[model samples]
Target: MTRSRTAGGGGPVALTPSERAERGKAARSSVRRSEQARFEPGPDRPDPVAILLEQEAARVPELVPIRRGRMLESPFRFYRGAAAVMAHDLGTAPHTGLEVQLCGDAHLLNFGLFASPERSLVFDVNDFDETHPGPFEWDVKRLAASLAAAGRDNGFDAAERTAVVLDAVSAYRLRMQGFSGMRVLDVWYARDDSADLRAMAAQGGGAMLARADKVFAKARSRDHLRAFSKLTHRVGGRLRIAPDPPLVVPLTELLDGGGPTDLDTGLRRLVDTYAQSLAPELRALVQRFRVVDMARKVVGVGSVGTRCWIFLLLGRDDSDPLLLQAKEAGPSVLAPYTAPSAYANQGQRVVAGQRLMQAAGDIFLGWERLTGLDGRERDFYVRQLLDWKGSATTEGMAPQGMRLLARVCGRSLARAHARSGDPIAIASYLGSADTFDRAIADFAESYADQNERDFAALADAARTGRVTTAEG
Candidate 1:
């Protein structure tokens, strides 16, 4: 693979196997720094519960109506409310030296199915914008909390919900133990496809096989061309994006009617950065497409305020359209506890982490800094916005299916951690699944309570006119 030079004349240096191993060791050493407490004294602010309420007040406008409606309910209201609290706990949590590319926000909802390079559906952690090197416990805690909350929403009793949370953690711990027994390359080469996963689930008493089958079917039905066709329509002779207010908007609204808009310039710069980020062959493959239009598209609850743009690119013909997403980068919630990244650019952090975690990534993955209309410089990484993606719906899943889904998420997370972390050390720390699972279950239940209090606080703020709620 041809190595592309950085924007200035200094090109990236290629590393030999030994050199790469040395770098990995150095990275691991940096992560070891996180095991010790480095809690900085800052201004005393709201408690974790209060902080969560404030965040919810800010996030309320961005949530879809369906999610918003759920928030109106008690426990569901609490889960949305307690995100910041969970973040706070994670920020101050105890750590082990073993570190991988951590998914800073490892909520249950974040796991999903996506197409690999081989066109097979695989289940894995789907979001990495908040990824950083930190204590693995933080991710485990967050995932557990999300599962507990999700279980509540699914109408499971408290004990049953606790069991589900424990099972998820146990799966992660056991999988990490298994990974510790494998050769480094063997662990790295491991990939899970739908068929294998379904088989595994089937072996586990047909736990999640049916739901997995449904989600896999839905995801495999979606591909690049199908996605583009669904999102684009012909307006006269020109291809234009169909607008869905608050969620999706046309590019014209985001740009001035000049030769090229601010978005266009930002996108071009981002593409150039992305080209440098890719391995040589992938970069060359991406060069064939010419960017035509871009649109600002809103996605996910936590990511609503952040700028996310979908670029429409043209290949040899109009029929060959590719959609890429460039989402703004911000400080990782884990930054307060984790070692500071060597890379200054948050987008670069995201792009680097995604490449390290995924077997094969989108060719267009890149990052650039853009000055918004308000003169604030925002960093962003670009990738295929939604190419053959789908996830198991927690709401509709049966208890057994949910348990299996949690296990799949846990195992996949462990695999990712194993690839980038010292599996033997991590496995040792995790020891038995029982203790870790119980710990996570405890944390999840406590966090869910915190979320409720926070949600109420947000509701109170809205009721008292501290924040405004958008009407559907």
Candidate 2:
């Protein structure tokens, strides 16, 4: 690939518009668009269960089962948690040289509604834990495959599933072409508006439009106040996040022999280090609050085993609260397949990638490196725990609603890539025809079939006592 280190590289020489477009057209010679449809997992593929066990070595011992069990929940769930396996498989796959700031795990459910710094709701890619630079098609393939898996999970027939995948790929191709002609700043400022999303849903039919409305309404009510009500309770006149065992445990509870006083002090120090990465104004805003409680929070299928903590702070009184998540950052799943990150800190890698790809990001978005209670240094990226955050419920979605969401997510991914990658070249590569679109649909269906077999393998492993799963 010409550009490989987190998508924003152009060397010392800036290519002219014509040259950029030419560069894209030339990529077709390296790997034809139709060839992208191929997904032949060779006989030497790594054992999927072995990959999961290796990842578990660094995770909390007791929580490993929860992560494994969550992955075994369904074929779709298995796909969500198996990014490392896909990375290994894609590492061996052919690709175009074009690179972009990738949302390394760009599943459909990862796209969501969240309030921007302007406090206006917008739709965009919300997960960046595995964000890295790689072939633009890697992200596209992941999204398409997720759609195929969801379609299968929802029991849609093959014809309907292909149609859903096509809608998404077409939206991405057409949007990239539109982006290719825009001014640099215009491309950077492109965002997904709720009104535009509503209109797209309307094209899907009345039921899809109604579902869109429901999602928007639910997103609006998911601010910090809602988090406080749902996650906290009054404990001896102090608001504290309620404990839920392996799922959610207060910091003082998790750390052996550490009282709240000592725990708060350490958490306060971590917050101070985290604030230094933010802009001065935001740092000052955060300094106004005192840390009240910190909790170990297990979140998401792929992210369950990571060291994720949520900090509760009150601005003025118990009535004013802000929850911020400090999620441990590690090497991107794409790292082995692509170039190593230019940034030394994994947290900084995530923060930088998110800033480059999103139209707008959380005001509190930043990164830090500090020694954990285990006495080993680790990187963490921090952001508001909830700011009108909402993800699509992939299960039980109607085919029409799924198709509409596919379009929405495709357009969102194209917008993200256009900001950090060469839009002109990518648009040229995709071209005006639907050849690449159909090819990706083929690849998606094929990969989804592979995913079912992998899921079955994991189930077989569980039955044979090779892996332990969480109990109900």
Candidate 3:
């Protein structure tokens, strides 16, 4: 299975499987698995609140409070919105230099079930806003720490949380071990569809399998039509998006009595340019539908204040509806720590990284750069607004339930990293022992403690009126 292929940089160079394995062994010597357990905040660590404040400078003024409020809800919620803070902390940490496209904010909630190009429910990393190439362990640590924080939110004691974190790290170690020995294309094509998930769940017990089935059924039910019905209504016999205010605001309300077409014209232009980024088939498929409606949409915790929008199109009458979301793509949160993306447009950076890491991506996935309604140029990546999307509930999850979910998440992350990284090297470094898993589990507990202190900083800022916050 040894073949010459370039790993995102330089020319193709031949390296035998054994050579790759030796590279992994060398990395282990440089950074021992037991050393992965070390995590302690330095005295010079940046102020978490100040980092949030700096981050909000590029976001919409009115929406910044909403972002703060969401982060203020809980430590886990804060963790969700505090990717920048974590990025800063990670800067001071050590890494193996085994690079992969990181799910820059690879928290537990970021992993979910979505419809693949083949229309099957594939479980994989669902967020890419902060994705970039960096040390593979960064993403793993992100996921591991998230489990610890979420466990606290769900009332799990320290021991239970550590055990759950171990389940994820162990699954990742074992899965990478398996991938290291597989053929390259075999590793590239590997994916965990519904059947794979069900099989894995079956071994956990009937209760776990039933829970997985429930999540699968829920994902299967959420398609474009379902999203259209929930988010649209007839206004003067013309379909338009229903305003949920703050969270979902129609573009008309933001126009300030300006000409109706001014902003709509800008959005249409965005769509036109976005179409160019798609394949000829998708471009033709998209041209068949007229851009009917578009609105400002605040999505996800960390992405709340970004320039996110939802566009509605109809073809072959109202029954045939397509909803696409154009989300603003900024620099990767890991950009400062690793290296700047080679891409000029942030949207393209996201698209390229996503295509490299995900088993499958949305068919309509594309990117465009446009002068927005504010007369500012912005980068955006477009995809379906909603298509068979669902996630496992972390709140109130039992210890074993979390452990089962962790196994799925850990393996899922490994599969993603394997696509873009040297799996043989990584597997060799991890070896066949639980040493790496236990070390990471220890790091997770320590990081979770640091996260709580950061959460308290934000809380204090809100109480002192140092940062404005609003109800979501």
Candidate 2 residues lying further than 4 Å off, grouped into runs, are 1-11, 256-265
Candidate 1 local lDDT, 1-472, one digit each (tens): 1122243557675434344334434543443322322323235535643453444443324543333334545565446434555566656544554567888778877788887777777778878868888767777777887887788777899888887887788889899889877877888888778877888777766435665677777887787788788788887788877777666777676454457655567666666566666778888877888777777786665565566778788888998887888887877666767789867989989888877776555666777776652256778887886767887667756677778877888888898788776666666666652655676687778777656656777677658765555532
1 against 2, candidate with superior lDDT: 2
1-472 per-residue lDDT for model 2 (tens digits): 2232233464555677788888899999988999999999989999988987887787777887888899898999999999998999887787897989999999999999999888888999999999999999999999999999999999999999999999999999999999999999899888997888888888867877888899999998999899989999988888998998888998878776466554456566878789999999999999999888889889899888888889999999999999999988989988988888999999999999999999989999999987654556788899999999888997898888888889999999999999989999999999999999999999999999999999999999999998889942
TM-score of each: 0.83, 0.96, 0.97
Give per-residue lDDT, candidate 1, residue 299: 69
Candidate 1 TM-score to native: 0.83
Model 1 lDDT on a 0 to 1 scale = 0.69
The segments of candidate 1 whose C-alpha lies over 4 angstroms from its true place after superposition are 1-84, 204-208, 255-260, 371-374
The stretch of ten residues in a row with the least summed lDDT in candidate 1 is 33-42
Candidate 3 per-residue lDDT over residues 246-291, each given as its tens digit: 8888888777546667567878898887989889999999999988
